[model samples]
Target: MRLVSLLVVLLLSPLGRAAEQTYDVIVYGSTSGGVAAAVQASRMGKSTVLIEPGRHLGGLSSGGLGATDIGNKA
Candidate 1:
């Protein structure tokens, strides 16, 4: 009985299942750096995915801070 149970458990285990997805690069956020990383990965011919936790992208840039200057203008 113990052997049979072990065999059944092994048969039902997910050890041999292949992953549903494979990405060369995965960006965890939709912020400027995350977007840039994803873009760079794609530009280098790599598969990439950009995941955002919120309903929008660009973080502060898209959060009503449109007039903020990010770089020095001197």
Candidate 2:
């Protein structure tokens, strides 16, 4: 759920271009989805960079959250 929410926010986020270097994909956050995106791109042979403006990473996963209930559909 968090990944999906982050992805939607990322898709709606603004686009940026870097002048110093080049990358096939530039993820602008340190959220789990952002890291996943950068990793998958690298695995697929694309140059990638993750620019985390904040001081943290891993999104809610870094906060020690637990799993949801068995019937969670949201």
Q: How far is candidate 2 from the true structure (C-alpha RMSD, Å)?
A: 14.2
Could you estimate the TM-score for every candidate?
A: 0.60, 0.56
Model 1, position 41: C-alpha lDDT score:
98
Best-performing candidate as measured by lDDT = 1
Residue 48 Cα positional deviation in candidate 1, in Å, after optimal superposition: 0.3
Cα displacement (Å) at residue 19, model 2: 6.8
43-67: candidate 2 lDDT, tens digit per residue:
9999999998777888777755646
Q: lDDT value for candidate 1?
A: 0.88
Candidate 1 residue spans exceeding 4 A from truth: 1-19, 66-74
lDDT by residue (1-74, candidate 1, tens digit) is: 99999888877889735569989999998988889999999999999999999999998878878676657496
| Residue 24, candidate 2: alpha-carbon lDDT | 90
